[model samples]
Target: MQNGTVSMAELLNSSSALIFMGTGCSSAVPNAMCLIQPSDPPCSVCSQSLSIPPDLNPNYRGNTSLLIDHLQSNGEHSYILIDVGKTFREAALRWFTFHKIPRVDSVILTHEHADAVLGLDDIRAVQPFSPTNDISPTPIYLTEDSMNSVGVKFPYLVQKKLKEGQEVRRVSQLDWRIIESHHEKPFVASGLQFFPLPVMHGEDYVSLGFLFGETSKVAYISDISRFIPSTLSVISKSGGGQLDLLIIDTLYKTGSHNTHFCFPQTLDAVKTICPKRALLVGMTHEFDHHKDNEFLTEWSKREGIPVQLARDGLRVPIDL
Candidate 1:
């Protein structure tokens, strides 16, 4: 498994980067519950999400998603997407235009939840081009259990025969590859290697985090209530125990949830992993981005590790 770790020399270009497609929880920042219901005082975060010059609005988020623009040797780009959720179309309309992303080369699913997999039907939007979609089927990597859930939820996506009568329709042409669990070996996607880190979402359900990149090792666990021992071991053992970046789940400011990391749990995990830099994601409308980020900046100084919040359209360069 530790055969060939990418060397620092390979990262001199330093052009590769990760773009946050969406950084909000399932409902997003200004969801219907918050907007339509309109609490007496009105949700401050949801209210501010519609501020003028929306590009600068951190609160306007879609479901948590990550796009890795891996720069290839021939000056080409490989776009590997992680989690196309319930708000995939909306996120795409805004982010794809803002970032000028031409296409999505591959997809990786962390779990089977609606926040992670509902966007499967929309993959056709970026397979090759907009209207034609005449390229090869995009490869999607996911665990067997998650794939089972997908098969149950999206039977036609897994098997074309299920939609035999609907062959005329141009559904998302996808290639499903059932991968093993976190304990299994690493897999390659679009020339980049990724190691799955299995984590507990709730008591019975499990989701995946991923560790990827060459010199700039980044560990991204977008949804997790707890980190498993085996997963922690892999994180510490890899790259001689030095992780460049960690993007983790921080569902709320305080209080614990059964399926996601809260503020205190996020602090604990950050202390353990001790990455050079950490960015929190999967937030609800409860957090004020500027306020929380300001607090986190001071906290990062105290902890000696730069930590902050990730918002939709935020991009961070990484050495690849």
Candidate 2:
């Protein structure tokens, strides 16, 4: 690792820690949007408006990758991954290569959406070489609704037993944690405590964002319609004065999106949370990295907050 930084095992032994290995958008999109380039149809501005990494960089990837570093003095300093999207496999590979994380102790599922959970099987690639912790399952925690939905969509994990002990080896055993509906309460599973917030996702189902703590607290709430009073209350109670970090959704630009946070509103929420730094995640093709940062820098200066616009493989140091 970096100088003065402890190993994953050592960090698990200490307290007060956080790490974010990737912060791309939700799609793990390539350098630019696949459709409509600078020379394409309509006009240059139209094509330019839909790009993220700009047409100049060829190696950009869309979607966000998050790693929660929590280790408090001789305890298990494991990680809590917020969302594992369709690009999860690639995201995981990139994360390991960049951060050198040999294994991820657990994963937290935000919702059952494809961009959030489709990479569930990618864990197989990181399974302990010698099978640490008694060959137990990797331990994935999710809200009740998410677990039910995951069970339905990926039924192979819990299907009937064909052989004897074969059932024990399926993606390991999926340990289920039933979360409360209060949404503001903080609960613990595996070895960490998570502050759960209820969010509305397009009238279809209930989605959740979480604040997990191995030692430090990081609030992750993207893909929500609006942050209601209850949500704010949870923020104040869980985050208290401020947060170490906040990963929020910024799906649209400045306009009002019916089911998601527009740029200005997201900025407002950032003002409320007032974390040391806020990184925007879950972005769509509507944002252009180089151009968006110019606007974000002005906003950050006006708001007196530090904001980092995400791109694929961007590794940010979360102060330990």
Whose TM-score is greatest here?
1
lDDT of residue 317 for candidate 2:
45
Name the 10 consecutive residues with the lowest summed lDDT in model 1: 5-14
Candidate 1 has an lDDT of: 0.85
For each candidate in turn, the TM-score is 0.90, 0.78
Residue 33 in model 1: shift from native, Å?
A: 2.2
> How many angstroms is residue 134 displaced in model 2 relative to the true structure, after the best TM-score fit?
9.0
lDDT by residue for model 2 (163-240), tens: 765534435344556666455567765457787877776655667888665335577886777765677765652445
How well does candidate 1 score on lDDT at residue 171?
76
Instruction: Output the lDDT of residue 290, model 2.
Output: 76
Candidate 1 lDDT, 1-320, residue by residue in tens: 13576554344234788999999999887766877788889988887755645577898878999999898777777899999999888878888887777888889999999999999999887765534435689999999998889999988677755444553456798999877666567898898899888999998988999999887888989999988988887676342486889899999898999999999999888888888889989999888889999999999989998999998999887877
Tell me the TM-score of model 2.
Answer: 0.78
